[model samples]
Target: MELRVENLTVARGGVPVLEGLEFTLSPGQVLILRGPNGSGKTTLLRTLAGLQPPLTGSVSADPEQITYGAHADGLKATLSVEENLRFWASVHGLADIAPAVDGFNLRGLLERPSANLSAGQKRRLGLARLLVTGRPIWLLDEPTVSLDVASVTLFADAVRAHVAGGGSALIATHIDLGLKADTLDVGPYKADAHRPRTDGMRDAYADFDEAFS
Candidate 1:
C-alpha cells in the first residue's frame, strides 16, 4: 500500500494550520512527523483520518483505508481488555485478535477491565487495536504518551511488523522508535493566512463546523 498526500491543507478553529503539504508513504515504510507543539500535527492527522475535511487541496490515495490512533487510547473504561479487542475486531470484520494481543504482550491483562489497567497497559491496548483493524494506512498522533520505555519499544515493534507485512504508517510523534524511516517537519508548511484564495477553493472561513475540526 502507498499513501500519497499532495497539496493538502488542513485547519483548526477555522484557520489553516498546514498548507501545501506533499508526501508519500510506501509499503513497509514509516514516516515520522517532527514539529513543535501546536504545529498542526494533530490537525493534519485528524483531517487524514476523515475526522475533518481539509480547507484546500486533496489527500491522494484513499482515506477510507486508513486507521487512526491517538493519545485518548479509544478504549471503553468499563470493558475488559479482551472485550475491547473483540469489539474492534468485530468492527473491522476480523475474527482473530491473537496477533494483536501477543504483539503488545497483553495476555495477562486481557481479562481485566480497561478501567483497572495502568496507563501503560491502556496505551498498549490502544495501539493493539490498529492490528485488528486490518487497514493498510495508519495515522498516529502522539501515540507514545503515557507509555513507559519498554511499552514504547513494544509499540515500535508492532509498527515494524505492520509495515513489514506491506502496511504503511504516518506517525505524528517526537519519540525515536528506532525504526528505519524518513522524517518530515510540518512547521514550514504552516498556512499563510494573509494570502487570498482567488481560485474559489473554499477557505476554512466558509463554514463554521467543517473548517473547525
Candidate 2:
C-alpha cells in the first residue's frame, strides 16, 4: 500500500494549520511526525485519516490503504472489550477479531467493559481494532500516551512486526516510541498565533498529562 499527499493544505475554522505539506509512504515504511503542542501534528493525522477536510491539495491512497488510531480511545464505554473489537471487526469486514486481540495481549481484558480497563489497556484494545481491520497504512496519533515501560515495548514490537509484514505508519508523538522511522517535524507548519483551538478532539496520549497526574 502507498499513501501520497501533494501540496496539502488543511485548516480549521478558516485558519490554516498545515500548508504545502507533501510526502509519500509505501508499505514497510514508517514516517514519524514530530512537533510541539498545537503545531498541526494532530491536524495532519486527522486529514490523512479523512476525518478532517483539507483546505487544498489531494491525498492519493492505495486499496485498503489506511487504518487510523487517534488520541481518542474510540471505544464504547458501555461495551466490553471483546464487543468493541467485534464491532470494529464487523465494520472493517473482518471475519474474526480473536487473533488480533490475542496478539495485542488483550485476551485478559476481553470480558471487561472498555471503561473499566486501565488507560494503557484501552490503548492496546484500540490498536487491536486496527490490526483486525488489516489496513496497510497506519495513522497513529500519540499511541504511547498512557503506556508503562513494558506496554510501550510491546507496542514497539507490534509496530516493527507490522512494518516487516508490509505495512506503513505515520505516527504523531512527542516522546520517542523506539520505532525506526524517518522523522518529519510539523511544528513549523502552523501559522504562529495564540488562537483558541476549535477542534473538539483532544490528544488521547499526551505525555504532559501523564507527568502531571
Candidate 3:
C-alpha cells in the first residue's frame, strides 16, 4: 500500500499553515515529520488522517486503511487495560488482542483501570489500539510524549515491526523515536506569515473589535 500527497495545502481555522506539501509513503517505510512548535505538523497529520479537510491539493489513500493516534491518549478512564483493548479490537472487527497486549507490555496491567495507570502506561494502551485496527497506514502525532526511555524503545520496536509487516507510518514528533526513516522538515512549508501576526492583547482586541463592530 502507498500513501501519496500532492501539492497539499492545510489550514487551521481558515488560516493556511502549510502549502505545496508533497510526499509518498510506501509499504515497509516510515515517514518522520519534524517541525518546531506551531509549524503545522499536527495539522498536516490531521489532514492526512482525514480528520480535517485540506484547503487544497489531495491525499491519495483509503480512509479505511488509516488509523490515527493523536497527542492525547484516547483511553476510557473507567475501563481496565484489557477491556480497553478489547473494545477497540471489537470495533475494528479484530479477534485477537494478544499481539497488542504484548507489543506494549500491557499484560501486567491488564486488569488495572486506565485511570489508575500512569501516563506512560496509558500511552502504551493507546498505542496498542492501533494494532487492533488492522490498518495499513498509521498517522501518529507526538506519540512519544510522556514516555520514558525504555518505553520509547518499546514504541520504536513496535513501529519497526509494523513496517516490517508491510505497514506504513507517518509520525510527527519533535523527540527522536529511534527509527530509521525519512525525515521531512516542515519549516520550509510553514505559512505563518500568510496570516497576520498578533503581538499582544491590544492587537488581538483591535482585530476582535474591528470584526465585531
Candidate 4:
C-alpha cells in the first residue's frame, strides 16, 4: 500500500498548524512523526487518517489501506473488552478476530468493561482493534500512552512484526517507540511566523517516556 500527501496544510479555528508538508509512505516501512506539545502532531495524524480534512493539498490513500488509532481510546465505555474487540472486528469485516484478541493477552480482561480497565489495558484493547482490522497502513497516535515498560516492549514487538509482515505505520508520538523508523518533524513547517522559534527536529522527543507521561 502507498500513501501520498502533497503540500498538505492543516488549519483549525482558522489557524494554520502545518504547511507544505509532504510524505510518501510505503509498505514495510514506518514513518515517525515527532514534535513538541501543540506542534500539530495529532493534527497531522488526524489529517492523514481522514478524520480531519487538510486545509490544503491532497492526501491519497489506497482503498481500505489505512486504519487509525487515535490519541484517545475509541473503545466504548459500556462494552466489555471482548465485546469491544468483537464489535470492532465486525466493523472491519473480520469474522475471526480471535487470533489478534488472544495475541494481545486480553483474555483475562475479556469480561471487563472498558471503563473498568486500566489505562494500559485500554491502550492494549485499542491496539488489538488494529490487528483485527488487518489493514496495511496504520495511523497510530501515541500508541504507548498508558502502557508499562513490559507492555511497551510487547507493543513494539507487535509493531515490528506488523512491519515485517509487509505493513507500514505513520506514528505520531512525543516519545520513542523504538521502531527504527524515519522521522518527520512538523515543527519546522509551521505556518506561524509570529510564534517564537521552538525546538528542532532533534528535540521532538528527548525520550519515549515524554510522549506518554
Best by the lDDT measure? 3
TM-score, every prediction? 0.91, 0.84, 0.90, 0.86
**CA error at residue 186 for candidate 3, angstroms:** 0.7
Candidates' C-alpha lDDT: 0.87, 0.80, 0.88, 0.81
Tens digits of per-residue lDDT for model 4 on 76-130? 9999998998898888888887776776788889999999999899899888888
Clashing pairs in 2: 71-204
Candidate 3 lDDT for residue 32: 92
96-178, model 3: which lDDT tens digit per residue?
Answer: 99999998899899999999999888898999998899998999999988889988898999999999999999998888787
| Candidate 4 runs further than 4 Å off | 193-213
lDDT of 2 by residue, 85-126 (tens): 888888888888877787779877888999999988988888
Candidate 2 segments whose C-alpha is farther than 4 A from its true place = 62-64, 192-213
Lowest summed lDDT window (length 10), candidate 4:
200-209
**Number of clashing pairs, model 2?**
1
Model 4 earns a TM-score of 0.86
Q: For residue 57, give model 4's deviation from the true position in Å.
A: 1.1
TM value for model 3? 0.90
Report the lDDT tens digits of candidate 1 across residue range 29-53. Answer: 8999999998899999888888777
